[model samples]
Target chain A: MVFVVVLLTTMLLCICIGSVNIPLKNTLTAMWNTLWGLELPAGVSKNIILNVRLPRVINVALVGAALSLCGAAMQGLLRNPLADGSTLGVSSGASLGAVISLAFGVSIPGLEYAGTMIMAMLFAFLSLLLILSLAYVLDRSMSTNSIILIGVIFSMFTSSAMNLIITFADDHARSIAFWTMGSLSGTNYTQSAILLGTLLICGGIILRYARELNAFAVGEDNARHIGVNVKLVKLVILITVSVMIGVCVSISGTISFVGLVMPHMTRMIVGPNHKRLLASSMFSGAIFLLLADLVARTLLSPIELSIGVVTSLVGAVAFIIIFYRTRKAR
Target chain B: MLKAENVTVRYGDHTIVDHLSFHLQEGQWLMLAGPNGAGKSTLIHAVSQGAPYTGSITLADKDIRRYKPAHLAQKIGVLAQKNNVGYSYTVEEVVGLGRYAHSRGFLAGKDDDGEARVENALALTGLTELRKSNVLTLSGGELQRTFLAQVFAQDPEILILDEPANHLDLVYQKHIFSLIHEWLKIPGRAVLSVVHDLSLAKKYGTHAVLMNNGKCVSQGNINDVLTPQNLQAVYDMDVYSWMREMLGQWE
Candidate 1:
């Protein structure tokens, strides 16, 4: 309940603090007007708040929630504190897919604008399939360590492949690099709707298994002993998380640390019960990313920093603190 | 209530539990007694369906594999030797997980009956006072008791345990065994445990299977299977003299 309020407040604050600073009062009025289909009050720039910042903030919030939820689920499913979407090569695969589309001018007919996103989502799932297959072959049990190892190796391989592609495609190199660093500069309502839809569907699926995830905390065999079909649960969770991460990466590029840090931070407060942890992580992630995005754009007036840079810079420091505190607590 | 017919569990080319057979009758406490590598744990794992095995292990005459994971859980509960809890879950929360098979739907909220069972389990394991405590902060005995509480909450007809008290003080061992003994007194309930302590087995087990190198050397009545000669044959040591010598230290 508090999270909802804080999230809304943060969204409104973010919308008001961009390059063209809008007053909080006017921002509230604009939001109210938009909500009831009323015309914007005088002195309010409808274009800036409604069109420009609203969707951008919404996208940032959705991406943050999606990434954090996946991180929490992955950590529980794999029973590894270090597990996240990136730990399984999904982010790198999305990056590789996006880079391919950009460099080779690959655009879907009648949906040219969505080609990169489509390809990104496609390759993200493909990478998960590849990693799981390899892990299965290596260890029929598909142990968590083997899956993580394969994912790390697959990430490196795809990153190298992406680099090679970038080196040859000089014209699209800058755009590819920028996209990889992530940005919410030109996001519109359509992408926000898509991201919201994905977050809802995937987040719902992940939330449905909170109890199974709790059962997993005691170990896979223990979970199995308690009636969880460990193999099926793993497959379902990984696929659902992959789709969520794929869509987020396709829309916003690979925003690091949100997936890794938010859950850890939330766990400290919510105490590792997925029933609360997963949902709390979503709100915490949304808040953190909204603030990070705010700092990214406004930290340097007229020269926006990449949102990914701000997140990594902030997330890394926060993560170190969390690690040290947890170690000390232990 | 539970029976194993020539169950064989293999890892790659190495067979761990080779053609082992055992049956557990309701109201009986069956102990798997063996040395470290005698396949006792493997057999328990095979019975719990945690490991792949060739032969049929049945619960109530149904092949174990044929039951759905959740359905099987309703019939059998397992308490492993060491439970690795990586996260900080409260004792009550951990015990509540035992109700998973009974709960229905995607968002399986704890029903009133589940809450009652969890409370009963906590009380049964003497962890009711520590219900809110984080399991990670628990002592070895307490941790073992926490898992024992979980299995108790599961309310299965058959309980498979791998070293229920492996590294606890004498008091914890007694507490755990006594709890199991009390639980087994209920009708239609049985327990299969892998025990390293022959004295505990002798005291608590109604039936015993003595194994070495994945093959059962002796079986049937606990006292008959644990004869000094059988112990010496499997352990290659004068077991009765060593036990008497250890008892002299107490005197």
Candidate 2:
């Protein structure tokens, strides 16, 4: 109840407190009028709320929820509390794909506007497969350290590849650099819809495996002993999470630490059961990003800091606090 | 009955268990005794169908590999020496995981029968008091007993345990052995255990396999396998003299 209330309130604030500063009553009234299919009043309020702010807020919400849930799943699947969406190089791989499509003007046949999205999703899956196969080849040990190390190496390679693409580009270098910093300014209803649909489908698949994830939290061997198809669970979770992160990054450009921070925060409140943790983190993440985006837009007033900058700043501080608290308590 | 016929297990190019064969009949408790690296745990892994091997393991006339994970888990349960769950769960939640094979949805089956078994296991393991405590806060012995309760709740037809008493106090260790002894008395249940305590093995093990360098040095009744001569041959020590000295010290 608290989470729902806080998330709704944060969404309201995010919609109301942008550069033009629409009143709360007008914001609510405009949303209601839009919902009931009535024509919005012809004013700056309608244009700002409907065209500018609502899509951005919805996009942030969807991306936040997807990333958080993916983080919870990865943590459970890998049996590592520190594992998150970015831990597997999904973000970097997606960024690389996005950079390639942007720099080379690549376009797929039916996905003109979503060419970058398609590429990002493809590369995200490819990176996961690469990590798994690399680990399998290197002594068949999917130990936590090896997975993390492999993910780091993939991130380095992708980032360097992205850099190479940027260097060769004469006209698109600035645009590619800005996109890599992650902003929600370009979102439209179409992009938001894609993110929302992906979150629903992938979230359903992930929730179905909650029990298996709980068993996996004990250890892979324990998960297998308790009748979970460890291999299947691992594959399903990795694919689902990669898809989620890919879609999120494609839409929002690699917003960092919502996955890592939101789940840890929710776990402190809801305990470690994945079922509850998953839901709580979804709500917490949505609220967290909504607030961060609000600050990103209005804190400097028209300068418009990148959403990734704000999230990383907040996420790093939060992670340090959590790490310190846990250490001190222990 | 669970039977392994010429089961050969290998890691890379090195063989761990070489052409080993054993029969574990219902209602029998067999002890696997060996030095630190004698491949006892690897053999357990092979029999539980958790690892790849050359030969066959059969339970109740069905090939072990043919059983799905859930079905196989219902037929056999294993308790390892240590368990590491990345997140902290309540003791009851951890114990209830044993019913994962029988469960259909989240948080185990929660049927009356499953709940009753979990309760019984917790009581037997003396973990009823800690049922609500986070497993992360548990002492080593407490964690060990908690997993024992988990295996008990699994209610498998066969139990395979690797050093189940590793971190227990003397009283709990004796209690755990007695509980295993009692569980083995059931008509269609059996136990395969790896234990380092020779006195306890001699007292409770109905049959035994003595291993050295992955080969069985002796196999048969407990007395024959645990004879001082066989013990010395396998361990390269004066077993009778060491036992006498230890017994004197205990007195």
Chain A fold similarity by TM-score, each prediction: 0.97, 0.94
**Most lDDT-accurate candidate:** 1
Q: Score the docking of each candidate (DockQ).
A: 0.88, 0.81
Backbone clashes under 3 angstroms, per model: 0, 0
Per residue, candidate 2 scores C-alpha lDDT tens digits across A50-73 of: 889999999988888888898888
Model 2, span B36-77: residue lDDT tens: 888888899888766789988898888988888888889899
In angstroms, how far off is B12's CA in candidate 1? 2.0
The lDDT of each candidate is 0.90, 0.86
Candidate 1 root-mean-square deviation in Å: 1.5
| Model 2 CA lDDT for position A174 | 86
Q: lDDT by residue for model 1 over A196-225, one digit each (tens)? A: 899889899899999889888668988999
Worst 10 residues of 2 chain A by lDDT: A138-147
